[model samples]
Target: MLTLNVVNKELCVGDIRIVGVSSASIFLIGDTEVVSLSSMFDTPPESVIIAPFVPLPTEE
Candidate 1:
């Protein structure tokens, strides 16, 4: 199964690579990122679990 680190310092993400979103923030991810991440595992996982979105603070 594929494994991933929730946090990493060396990895660089740009603004355009967002995958998920919340009212306050966005998830930075891309197709290439997923493919590269998938390769990290010897066996594929059944599915990926994503967190639920939440509301962000309003911008006055």
Candidate 2:
């Protein structure tokens, strides 16, 4: 399992079943879940992509 401390308040945890490291991005699979974390070659990412398969409930 791989864990990343993101922004000090949030944590990005995933089991590294496999890693496809390219010159562009790093792909990971955790507990039947797949995610991609990438850094732009020219620009930085303003937002990260969260997999829809992982759900977070909204509060009303």
Candidate 3:
């Protein structure tokens, strides 16, 4: 059993610039009662490839 409550009177913002946001993420400005975020990145042993060394040609 769980109970949550949130009350906000006033909120103001001028300018907000965000470049990038990745994975399990939560971007909030005002108010929040409860927030839960979880991220899991698993790379297996046999899930990787290694063998490449090619340089790009430069402009003359």
Candidate 4:
């Protein structure tokens, strides 16, 4: 059981920049009660691979 007596207020944002938000990422900017996050990678042991570093192609 949970209870929240939230108050009222004003929020302002100016000139804000976010670089990156990966998988299972949450970006909150206000009141919140409960937040649950989970990240799972279900892969067999033999399915993993290690290879050379190859950058992703980008537009010119």
lDDT of 4 by residue, 1-60 (tens): 466677869988676555544444567787787877665568986886645443444545
- For model 4, the local distance difference test gives 0.63
Winner on TM-score between 1 and 2 is 1
User: How high is the lDDT of residue 12 in model 1?
Assistant: 69
TM-score of each model, paired residue for residue: 0.19, 0.18, 0.40, 0.43
> Which of 1 and 4 is ahead in TM-score?
4
Worst 10 residues of 2 by lDDT: 16-25
Q: What tens digits encode model 2's per-residue C-alpha lDDT throughout 4-59?
A: 55343455876533323333444432343446555444445555544434333544
Alpha carbon lDDT at 53, candidate 1: 68
Candidate 4 deviant stretches above 4 angstroms: 1-10, 45-60
Clash tally for model 1: 1
User: Can you give the lDDT of residue 21 in candidate 3?
Assistant: 49
Q: Candidate 4 clashing pairs?
A: none
The list of candidate 1 runs beyond 4 A from truth reads 1-26, 29-52
Clashing pairs in 3: none
Residue 33's lDDT within candidate 3 is 60
RMSD of candidate 4 to the truth, in angstroms, is: 6.5
Poorest stretch of ten by lDDT in candidate 1: 30-39
